[model samples]
Target: MNLAESLGDCEFQSVNTAYDENMPVDRKVLVDNATLSGVERLIGESRVRNLGNVDNDILCLEKLLTAILFSDALMAIDDYKEEYRSKRSRQFSFIKFLKLDHVSYADLSGKAADFARSMTFSFDGSKPAGDVVSFFEALRIDPQLRWDVFVSSEYLTMSLLVRDTRDVGYENSIDGVFRNESANADVVLAGIKFDAPVSMEHHAEISSIKDLVDAFASNNPNFRGSSSGSLLARCIFGYGWAAERSYFYNAVAAQNNASVFLAPLRDAFCEGCCRLESRSQVESLLAALKSKSQATMAKIVESSGQAKFALKLPFFSAYLISICDNPRQCIEHALELRNRSEFRDCRSILHNLDFLSVGERSAELNRILGLLEQSCDSLLRKYGVATANGLQVSLSLGLAGISAGTSIKLDRLFPFYRNRPFSRLFRNIAQDMVNVERLGGLYEKLCASVKEHQDAGYPSRTSVTPKFMERRENEYGRPAKL
Candidate 1:
């Protein structure tokens, strides 16, 4: 049995919440207390705003019921075959978990019963008290969840996003929010790529997102990037190590003081009610706000896309508004959009469909390629990238992930620029800086070779990656040692 169950002796029920006797009621749950977020915030929303259509709510509830997973705990025990991710920390007990797309509840009957109970709450948009109980019980007995505990400090993959605090908070998934230290912990996830939040002056890219997130997760000692990120975001999310809300005690900007606004945010909260008078106090207030905000966010998620799409522009824009303000919202938006049959359409037809008649396919591909060339010309002029002797190089490269030389002539008008397509391929791979530089630098020499086809087009053609050449040489006897 998991440690959470070992402490208690009663038979665990999936649909009934057994209140923890260790939990104190008179004391505030946020101030120097264990952060307990109820699954109700996510599962209990339909009763209050029965205002929305039941069809959509039913769909979303079903989606969330099966989709959400706690990967960290499953991995630590090492018995669960399900994919798992965890966080490394200074606070000792803080952990984060992620459930990927492949896993699901092996016992569907219990899950459906629990979710049905959660949907029948009293609040207009209530929390799922019963749902939390079910989740904990199910996790305790599930073969994957009941695996052995981890002896080493190795954390999970995507779940590296948790705080490093141990004294005041413990990682509890049934609560619907992760609890970790706020003092100085940092949690980061690698490999999950994201584009920067859209902004002016700074061109945000996916690699930049990965790097920034890694820096926060690594908590400085493990982080190796040169850039600095918004410290407030990390602290707000309780991803910092050694820093609890109490650390804000000495700062005038104590997050709870309610009087410490910088004029702009002065009106965000009532005067003196949300001021941060000290560092520890600031931590306390922010931690509280984050706790509350977590619930509100879950509520919003429950009501997500419940309304019908009457007007396309306003509907899409409003949906994007929710997503733009928060990263989780962004993910949910993408998921929702994917489920909509209405928005799917053919984006462009330029790639190879070799089985079709060559003449007709060639004509269609050429027409599409022509349009791309025109667009590239415009982008270069607008973005202030001067077009030299050839066409706008970047845009012509266009759609990513096909082999690098698939469209060599699309970006270059010169019959002599045979290697241009290869160059464009590398440049189009936004996250791939290495190949882009290597390809960009070799373009001129390749172009010259293209012009003097007899002088050494062979070397230009042969100058591919060593990895590919290795495979090729394995087949065709190591070609004259380059």
Candidate 2:
């Protein structure tokens, strides 16, 4: 069904921001033909309208247009399947910022279908290739900081470009898109605010989006060692938990590295990916791994009868290196892991495990910790990453919880990300992230006070002030001098 049709019969429920003067009107955006088509038309006319008027404002508009398109594409995909949305949120912590949880699954499905259809109807098979300013025009939006939403539209469009389109202009248009983005560097950076305590611009290694994109795109073997290290740091500093990110990164590294650091680790991870029986088992595995006890591990696995997917290696290493100091336990654990996988390099990971001196093992553990520490340092210097929690909450750095202990539970986090990765009708998370970063300790103090009040038998109070005067009141609580 079309957007109008889908929205006409919408059964979704949401907190209305229209009456909240403090909230911008854009936060209450509705995905109807008028709104979507207006943006489409705006982008369409920008090329001709901005022929000779190339300026900072116009460039910012172009980036904003791209951001809008990118966010739309992401939202469309979230609508298509719940998994994609959850995976991205877990990876990027986008849900914390975007508030995808408030939306209904049914609403997502309908809107996703409309976005898919619109892509087909609007641009056709050809790229919307135009001049320098073809993608945007100089116009201040109600909420200017919602540029992250705008950029998300690009990924959906890019996926189509990569998969569906065979147009001759695709390559040229894609190049043009990047070129324009590069030209509008100020505009792009403006949209992405890094307000963490550290300075990202000062870091030489990963100072910009170009750097991140380049690392993700690199193919050189020489770069693998450094690139993997950087990626690992990004995952840790940017995200909250280490389960899925560890699995993804380890799998990627195993594909390239011939030398296996730990035997049965990769195999166990792979097996877990293929054979895991239930979410409960996954939860058990997370708890057992965190416990870092051999007996605990065996008991959990045996009781659950779960597959090897539940035995992730990085978690094992984290404990083995950090907390667990028993040689006998380490040997027993390695033997248990060995009993499952037949990888020839398993010996490399497990052989002579029982014989190593404490100093040697400690040295190895120290090395691992050093790598992690270096990575964390890099993120702080390069991306302004604060604590893993701060990054997750403030920057949407993908801090998905593996267990219920840290971050959000996988079950809840996943579904929200899957269905509503980006929202057209919710609060702007990007703005929120900035405020959280800017406020820092003050933000935490404010939250604590609010919680304290709630716990002390305070109930919600309805506003007595007029809607139009609320913004002014918030800014001016004092009596007027006049």
| Model 1: ten consecutive residues of lowest lDDT | 305-314
Model 2 per-residue lDDT tens digits across residues 28-135: 111111111112222232222221111212222222222222221111112213433344334322212223232333344333223222211111111111110111
For model 1, how does the per-residue alpha-carbon lDDT over 86-197 read when each residue is reduced to its tens digit? 2112111322222322232222223322222222111011111221222222112110100011232221111111223231111121111212222111222111221212
To one decimal, what is the Cα RMSD in angstroms of model 2 from the true structure?
Answer: 28.6
Q: Rate the local accuracy (lDDT) of all candidates.
A: 0.20, 0.23
Local error of candidate 1 at 459, Å? 42
Candidate 2 segments exceeding 4 Å error = 1-373, 383-482
**Ten contiguous residues with the weakest lDDT in model 2:** 138-147
TM-score of each candidate?
0.17, 0.17
